[model samples]
Target: MMEREARRTPPELQELTEQLSLRWFGRPFIHEAVYNPRLRTTGGRYMLRDHSIQVNPAVEMMYGEEELIGVLKHELCHYHLHLEGRGYKHGDSDFRELLRKTGSPRFCKPLQAEQQRTVRHYRCADCGRQYERRRRVDTSRYRCGKCRGKLQEVQ
Candidate 1:
């Protein structure tokens, strides 16, 4: 099945961010909104120094508008609070309150493009020792450390 593309242009994203800010937070988002290709698992991030919001391109491309909006809101919570000299950190009360008020998710979903872990299970043929590895082990060359037994693939 094909995934829907929800990627927005930079200008469109900026407009959306501004609209959301005015609609929910009752403040204008003055800083720029830009897509960041380098952002992997993170949906969005608000730069403390530049006051700019960087959004992961994968948010909309893989997730959808709702997820993208949620990421935007999450970053906005950090943006507004930090600019006002209030508690903007995840641990702070103000940040938590804003998140609650805005209904923004505390964390973004993991990227769909992220590689899934490959776990290889192995057992010693002689000693019955078990081992889990990310990569395949050469059973012919590698021996069990415990009993120096030959290892066999479990699955």
Candidate 2:
């Protein structure tokens, strides 16, 4: 389940789960759902080892609850289908069908709030071409690929 660390209460989670389950699966989710802080890169994951659902808190923190709910539904597709002995794996027919049937999101999209933010800027020493990056580049190790020239930081 993916609601234990959730900012939402048990009752809220239960309600949310029910609503999503019904809206997507047309069936009730009878198990626990929880928020997992250790998740990374991925939006959510199903514990094949334990049958519990682990949702990335970053899904909500970065993307918001709507996307978080989508992540839940995506995981639920695995949860309910697995519990019912249906295709739970992503490549399985049942899983694919369920995704379409429930309108659950297939991919957990990242938050775009900072899409325009720039952290590092670079200039080509030879051509003065400019490049922007979100991470710092090692000037000693990196060279401008376009002009095969040295790159310098511009503020």
Candidate 3:
């Protein structure tokens, strides 16, 4: 039973989204909500063509139910505004106003995995100058700008 309850089924997620729509937006959600595991950088998104809400399953797994609810609310704001032919884009006044009125987050918190990314630190062999990069820098090809010294990976 633990495995069965490990994740919310698609139907349960759909129901939850619908309920949030009614409670927060004062309107019933007629669209679908599904888990999109491919979402790496975002917590959730509202699809304009299909009017569906795609949630990153990792949001709930890493941040808990409250955070998941916040993501849902953010997506719902976009959904309702777009359907009503109002300004739904992030930069629009209508979108910002609705977000403020509903207390929905303008942006979701960064995922733990994203926050904990390994940054490669490099040091100049001669000058001892330091550099940090998200991707590995080839020590053989790259040299330090300060003293034109050989770059070496640190730690």
Question: lDDT tens string, model 1, 1-155?
Answer: 24677568899999999999998899999999999989876888999989999998888887789989999999999999999999999999999999999999999888775556678999999989999998999999999999999999987
How much RMSD separates candidate 1 from the native structure? 3.7
Best by TM-score: 3
lDDT of residue 33 for candidate 3: 97
What does candidate 3's lDDT look like per residue over 52-99, in tens digits?
999998888876778788999999999999999999999999999999
Which order, best to worst by lDDT? 1, 3, 2
Candidate 2 lDDT, 1-155, residue by residue in tens: 13233366546765787788888777887766776666656887888877766666666766567887888889999989888998899999999998897778888885343344667889999999999888899989999988789999998
Model 2 residue 31 lDDT score: 67
> Which ranges of candidate 1 are over 4 A from the true structure?
120-155
Measured against the true structure, the TM-scores of the candidates, in listed sequence, are 0.76, 0.62, 0.82
Evaluation by lDDT, superior candidate among 1 and 3: 1
Clashes of 3: 0
Q: What is the lDDT of residue 148 in candidate 1?
A: 98
